[model samples]
Target chain A: MLKDITIGQYFPGNSVIHRMDPRMKIVLSIAYIVMLFMAKGFSGLAVGVVFLAICYGVSHIPVSLILKSLKPVVPIILFTAVLNMFFVEGDPLFQWAFITITKQGLSTAALMSVRIVCLIAGTSLLTYTTSPIVLTDGIERLLSPLKKLHLPVHELAMMMTIALRFIPTLIEETDKIMSAQKARGADLESGGLVQRAKALVPILIPLFISAFRRADDLALAMECRCYRGGEGRTRMKQLKLTSRDIVGAIIVALTIVAIILLNIFFPLAIA
Target chain B: MAAITVEHLSHVYSQGTPFEKTAVDDVSLTIEEGEFVGVIGHTGSGKSTLIQHFNGLLKPTSGRILVEDRDMWADPKKIREFRFKVGLVFQYPEYQLFEETVAKDIAFGPSNMGLSPEEVQMRVQQAAQFVGLRADKLEKSPFELSGGQKRRVAIAGVMAMNPKVLILDEPTAGLDPRGRDKVLGEIKQYHKTQGNTVLLVSHSMEDIARYADRVLVMNKGKVAMFDTTENVFARSEELAAMGLAVPQVSRICRGLAARGLNIDPNCYTIEQAKQQLLALRAGKGADQNA
Candidate 1:
């Protein structure tokens, strides 16, 4: 059941989005988020929606997967929409006893919901396309300039890469440990909150011990290979920005310009 | 009555996802009560997945598993009871030991069954004795013990439950030869004393030939054969085709037979092979005298 997590999940493909330089993808994703917030009304948000749709189309990721990524954020979207709907005061569109659905409130709620959905969809697309190792490499390269301030950028990136690499291994271990405990009649499903938490003691202790053991072994293995703090290190796959990355940056710039124009020229009627 | 029954069992990992793959296909088998069955298979042949169904640790994607003639997942909520009926000791179970004391680790199983403290203590002592763990060492922390000792403790933890059926998946993996023999001997003795059904999954054909009453051969998620140990070992070529082999003694006997000697190719155990060679020599001597 733990395998259902779509966070940090990478769907591998040979599409243009997947092949784009990871550094370019990360920068464009941040730029897209900024554009979404800059959007003033439905017309401005429509630009983001169109750009996102086109990106997904080229990436070849299935619609079901995109929907799966949005599933966990449904409650957050609803909460934001409801807070905007009833709490904001303006010209009342509909009135009951104490609650007033104002004209401005409805427009703001719709706009916020559209913006939040587009934000999630756009960002998840980046993770879906870029592999985790490449993503970390991209981040480290982008942060390389901070070395002038004596920051341990490479060490931090190495730590993140190692942590990401061990997630699936640790998850497999957890499943094995849980099954081993259950075979001995460990009741993890039914109980009060305290009882359930107490039952996890059997699982947690073993998991922690195994994880530490793995880390120790990994460190030893790295040392045996003459690893020394990422200094003077060489990479197997060098990151290079091809024409695909350049074209993607241009498309993103155009989308941002379109959002700016729409924000100025076309505002929602109610707003 | 059969101790465990699997009907058309199939398990698919990550179903409906792009990573979907069937780990176990449409397989059916029944293990009789008080029978010691050795399951032989290559890695990824679904040996582990198939046994996990016996105790409802994994629900089959399209089949039913019955323990002691009752459908394991019929109630779903009461499935824990089946775990107590069929105990599973996973591969390298020594890594699962987490208690402060060896005594406490063995008691984990019985205590989880809601047994009284006294009953739990009694069962823990019995299990420890069965696994040859001394009374004095019971108070020591399990983490401080040697690898073989920790493995025994993990086995005792499950044995304390006194399940009607015990399934072990490569329990001797990563152990020394002596350690492997000790653990396997303890399990054989436990089966004899308790008269419970036992399924031992191993890659070592010699070990299975030494202890198993019957052998079950699995290949590519299907039961290729299930028969008496002698019968399974006799078909060495067929077994070799499945990436398995008979005991080394049996292979030697087969070679002798191929060389026109009157040796039984089905002789698996060392004792049996010795007896066969002795009989063949005696018969030759008598014929020469005639």
Candidate 2:
């Protein structure tokens, strides 16, 4: 059950998106999200949707996987849509007592939901294409400018990379502990809310202890290796921008321009 | 009647996904009551997965597991009863210790069995004694104990339940030689005094040779051989092909047999090899005197 979490999961592939520079992918993802919100009318949203569809095709990631990433945010999406539908004021599309669903409200709700879905899909595509190590490297390189202000950019990136590396290890340990407790007749399933919370005591205490132990071991190992605050460390694989990254950046720029032009030509219906 | 019976049992992990794998496949075996059966296999050969089924921890995808002539999954609600009947001490069980005191950790299983508090305390003391834990250490927190002592406390936790069959998966793994021997000796003593079935899963052929009366060899999720310890070691070459080795003494006996000695090649223990060599020496001495 703990294995179902796919956050920050990278799928290994040889597609163009996978080959693009990590920094370029990260920048392009931020740009995509910006354009999604900047989009004013149906035409702009359509352009964003088409752009995502093309990215999905080029990345070769299955549609089902992209949909699965949205599972955890379903409630948030529904809440936002419902709020927009009831609150936005305009000509009434349907009237029922004080709760009137206006034409503009309905349109705004649809647009908001579309924008949120596109936002999630675009960001997940970035994680799906770039490995965590490369992503951290990209972030460290991008944030290196802040080093002049003594912000410890490299140290932050190193911590993130280590955290990502240990996620699966900790998950495996939890699974083993759960099994051990179950063998001792600890009923984790089929209980009231209070009973279920009580059952977690057996699992949580051991997990926390092991996690602390692992952290101590890791710190000792790092010290033994003379690791001192990520200074003077050189990467074996330096980041290089290739033709694919240049082409991806150009496409993102063009999409942003197109969204702006579409918004100017076809004004939003809600406003 | 057999204490446990596995009929054409097969298990596939993550079925219908791309990562699906047949961890245990079409395997079948029967273990009788009061018999000590040692399961030996290379890593990922289904040794752990198979033992988990004995206590209904894992359900077979294609076959059945019977504990004392009753299907383990016949009544899903009663699966907890099987856990009480078959105690499983998983690898590195020390990490499972969570109680504040060593005594409470040991009593976890017995209390879960709904026994009276006095009976739970009695079983806790007995289990701790079986693992050679000193009585004075019972009041201390488990985390305060040493590594080996923590492991003993974990084992006692399972033993307190007084299962009819005890299954240990590499109970001696990651322990020093002395610690390993202590744990194995306690397990042997448990089996001897309780006179109940014990299934020991290990990768050390020597440990099995010394303690197990019967050996079950698993290769690529299939039972390669299941027979007496002597017979299993006699086929050392076959075991070697499966990336397993026999006891050092058994290897020496086979080496001597290859050199045309009249000694038995199936000697699986040091005592057996010593007796054979002594008899051979006596025969030589008599021939010289004659």
Which structure among the candidates has the greatest DockQ?
Answer: 2
Give the per-residue lDDT digits (tens) of candidate 2, residues B1-290: 89999999999998998899999989999999999999999999988999999999898898999999999999989999999999999999999999999999998889888999999999999999999999999999999999999999999999999999999999999999999999999999999999989999998888999999999999998999999998898888899999999999988998999999999988989999999999999999999999
**Where does candidate 1 stray beyond 4 Å?**
A267-271, B14-20, B278-290
Count: clashes, candidate 2: 0
lDDT, each prediction: 0.92, 0.93
RMSD to the native, candidate 2? 1.5
Q: What is the TM-score of chain B alone in each candidate?
A: 0.97, 0.98
- Candidate 2 segments exceeding 4 Å error: none
Worst 10 residues of 2 chain B by lDDT: B228-237
RMSD of each: 2.2, 1.5
Task: Write the residue-wise lDDT of candidate 2 on A1-271 in tens digits.
Answer: 6786665779889999998889888889999999998999988999999999999998899999989988888899899999999999999989988899989999999998999999998999989999999999999998899999999999999999999999998899999999999999988887899999999999999999999999999999999998888688887998999988898899989999999998898886867
lDDT of 1 at A163: 91
